[model samples]
Target: MTTTTPRLTGEYAIDPAHTRLGFVARHAMVTKVRGSFHEFEGTAHLDSEDPGNSRARVTIKAGSIDTGNQQRDQHLRTNDFLDVPNHPEITFESTRVRQVGTNEYHVTGDLTIKSTTRPVTIDFEYTGSAVDPYGNLRVGLEGSVAISRKDFGVNWNAALEGGGVLVSDRILLEFDISAIKQK
Candidate 1:
C-alpha cells in the first residue's frame, strides 16, 4: 500500500480569530508573565512542491499588546517598552523556509521591533489541515522562539531589593496560527 500527503499549496491569509501571537517572560526572577498581541495580520504562500519557496509576512500593532492588566498594558506601550507612538508596528518577513523534519520547518526571518531589526528563526510544527464549517480550507501550525528583549532595544528594568532584576532579559515568542486558503 502507498500513501500520499495532501498538497498544501496556496496563498493563505491568517485568521486572527483562530490565531494567537503571544509572548512569555519571567518576572522578578520568580514567575512568568504572558501576553498576546490582539491586532495583527499575516499571510503565507505555501509551495508544497518546493517548501523552500514558501514565504510569510506579518504585521502586529504594537499598541494592541494585552496582558490582561490595564495598567501593565498601558505601560507596555510607553517609551519604556514598545514606544508605540514612535514604532507603531512590529513586523516579520521570512527570508527562507527549510524543512528540518517530516512535519517541522525552520523559518528564518527578519523580525522588526521598535525600529530594531534582527534575524530570528522559529521551528514550526505542521499541526494539521482541515475544511472549516464555513467551507474554508485551513492549515494550522505552532512555533516558539526565545530571544533577548534587549536585542530589540527594549531594555527597561529595575533591580530587585533582594536579588535579580525586575524583568527577565529573555522572552519566548509563541505562535498558534490558523491560515485560510484564499480563492
Candidate 2:
C-alpha cells in the first residue's frame, strides 16, 4: 500500500494555556475522577507531506498534578505514588508513527513516569489545521491511551471491607493538543 506524502513544515510548540493533558480513572468502581497536569511542555514536528514522519515530545512536571483536592493531590505525590521528590517528571518521546486511516495514526513511544520507562501507543487523530486569528498557524491532535498505574511504580492501595481496593490500576490518558507553528 502506498502511503500519502505529507508536506514537512515548521516547528511547533504546544500552547500550554490551550493544551490540556488530562486523565480519568474509575473511582470506587462506580464513579470517575478527572484531573489534569497543570504544568507541562511539549513540542511537535508537523509534516504536511509525510504524516508518519511527524513527531512529538512532552514533559510533565510531577508536582503539577491537581485533582481539585489538596489532600488527594498530596497523596499522589508521595513515595508510594508518583514520588515527585525522586521522579520529578514524566516524559514521552515518540519513536514511530504509522497511519491507520485518514487523519488517524498509531503513535508508539517510550513513556517514562516515576523512573519507569515503558512502551506506550496512543491512537491519535489529526483534527485538521488552520491559521488562527493571531496570525499563527496551528495544528490539532487528540488521542487517548489506557495504562496500568502499577506498571509505572504507583502501587499504593487500601483494601476495602467489600473485598475491593480504594485505587484502580487502570488510568485513561486523554490529550487535547493545540500547537502554534514557529515562524
What would the TM-score be for candidate 2 when compared with the true structure? 0.93
Best by TM-score: 1
- Candidate 1 lDDT tens digits, 33-143: 999999999999987767889899999999999999999999999999999999999999999999888778999999999999999999998888888998998988999
- RMSD to true structure for each model, in Å: 2.2, 2.3
Across 1-183, the per-residue lDDT of candidate 2 in tens digits comes to: 013334226689999988889999877777888999989999988666666677889999989999898999999899988999999999999998888887788889999998899999999887867778888877778999999999988889888778878778999999999889888
Error of 1 at 97 (Å): 0.2
Q: Which candidate is the best by lDDT?
A: 1
Candidate 1 weakest ten by summed lDDT: 1-10
